[model samples]
Target: MHAGFTLVEVAVVAGILGLLALTMTSAFEGMEQARQQNTAQAHAEAARQALRTFMLRNKRLPCPDNSTYGDRGREANGAGSCPGDLRVGWLPYESLGLQVPVRSQRLRYGVHRGTNADLVAPLHGAVDGPDLEGTGGLARALATAAQAAPSTDQPHYSGAVPALSSDTCASAEPVNPAFVLAAPATDRDVDGAIHPGFDGPNRGFATSSPCVAPPARPATRIYDDVVVAESATTLLGWLSTATR
Candidate 1:
């Protein structure tokens, strides 16, 4: 009558098996996440190495300006421009012989400058005066010329300035010569708030704003890695390894 086992015993065994299955599922999820993280880290390191090699061969860093070669020149401050005599711009990792799959978004280098709203001068008083009136005339012509001229603070690689989102790091400026290595924030959310920075890995920009509040929350992922020619390179990240 009891050759197999009691109903109660069978039920208990089934429960134990279910618990084990649940535990195994959780373990597997953790392993998968770990693997993804390791892969991402390895890819990032490879990109860095490739960049180093490119610099070594060309004696300059690649500048990403949407394929435009406008910013190549020498500034009074000693900053190098894009498409310099060296002719290096947007060095593709594939060209460098890297096997990793290149992310389209990651492939882009340099900051994206938004439209020049400020360049258009606002209408002022005395519109009818000879000094200010006349479309297509000398007065109007001068105004248009002034607007078209490059900003005195424009960067050499891309005369355009970086778009200033509300989430930009408190310390970030329009033209930062040291942007690559500086801890200035560089990312914003859909709402234009800056993400929190990682505290551990110690990579990426540091925030000058308070840690609390809506837009001040830290970032959750790594961002673009910007390198300036013959200068320090800055890595933008969301969370620090330590904090993670």
Candidate 2:
């Protein structure tokens, strides 16, 4: 007859297996977060280029989309409002004639309407209430997604929050936002529960002062608002250089 292994041996093997599984799981989570971060940054970069392209060709930024999801989220006319609260909102992605269903598409965007003196006055000409049309838009174009569960709130993605303002912490602070993007570092609705960090009550609104430099990791109360600060003056500068 063959002798079987002792109970301790079995327990030890089980422990080893559990540890290995945990290690693998952790690794996967890190990889996913990193991918999301890169994708968010990519979206921001693309938007910056898109805004510049639109300005170069049309001499003005396209208005933000004001309609709801049903209408493709674009302004009916040149009269859309991104609300005073957000200081930003869904950009007129369609009007800009950009490709839809972008790889890891940006969920939403915010732009200063030339209100914050610090962000706009520096530009030397950009004005306030530069409101554009925008309604919260697609996680990806023409689709509804369920996050965490079948009946849970669908989570949105993250992007670059470029601003021109001096104080990032104060909300209700307006600026001449020139189409900046922002993303949630975490699930906006965590398993059907609302969550902060990366995505919070102020999804695109970063209430951190001095536009605190974005962290390499995800968003937190302290360093959650990752933004990119650009101004009309900067655009004008770019224009001048391009024309030269």
Candidate 3:
């Protein structure tokens, strides 16, 4: 054999090194993603707790911001039930008056009372929670107010009424009073829409409409959504001291 290896041999060694580097890169990415997801979950819990605090202080949940995220109260009357076409929109981060929960420190919140076209975007293809559809899910609980007994309380709500069924839209008395939160992380593609989905391991979100719930699908370009939800019973339970 010659004193030194041929060009082909050196090429083979370089290729092997390249492949090894790629594998390590992918592994690191996976680990970072797991960490980010866990962090997002913690943030959601914090937001939920903050919401409870707001209710304790105000005796009622804050309304959706009229234009988009932030702001507070309602659009039509500045108080009472959220008013809008679907009554579904981004969460009132400023309204709730809670510090941003993520280390990145950005607004990551969404809510749906009844109407939010994006929640069910690609409506037919997207999967909806059995108990958390915009119409059949959170919206249904809200509908309870319509059929519920009138309120004697000053804040004035329908009080308790029957919850709605996703399939039949039937009532079950004492609606659960749940709502959806679309808390996506940051923008990845650099496109204006920053709903949810990871450009890298650093991104995470509570939920991004059209994908809804968990098991976010990257194939559908609907990854990075982290949905956090609460029922009226659980969320407003604190109200017992003030309202009940």
Checking candidate 3 for backbone clashes, the offending pairs are 86-115, 133-137, 162-173, 177-232, 183-206, 205-226, 206-226, 206-227, 207-226
Residue range 151-213, candidate 2, lDDT tens digits: 101112122443422222223322333344554444533323221343433332333211223
- Report lDDT per candidate: 0.31, 0.41, 0.40
Please say which candidate is ahead in TM-score: 1 or 2: 2
How high is each candidate's TM-score? 0.36, 0.58, 0.53
lDDT of 1: 0.31
Candidate 2 residue 239 C-alpha distance from true site, Å: 1.7
lDDT of 1 by residue, 1-244 (tens): 5588889999999999999999999898656545544453444455556555543343233443223221222211232333322221232444445552322213222221112211112122335554232121322322333344332232222223333222232222222221122121223222232222222111212222111111112333333222232112121111112113
Q: In order, how many clashes per candidate?
A: 15, 34, 9
Those runs of model 2 whose alpha carbons end farther than 4 Å from true positions after fitting are 69-73, 79-87, 102-104, 115-177, 184-198, 201-227
Looking at model 2, which ten-residue stretch has the lowest summed lDDT?
A: 134-143
TM-score of 3: 0.53
lDDT ranking from best candidate downward: 2, 3, 1
- What is the per-residue lDDT of model 3 for residues 1-244, given as tens digits with 9 covering 90 to 100? 6899889999999999999999999898666656655665666667687766765554344554444333333322454544433334445565666543332333334333332221212122223544222223323333343334422211111222312211121222222224444444433334333433432211322222211332232311223434465644454344434444
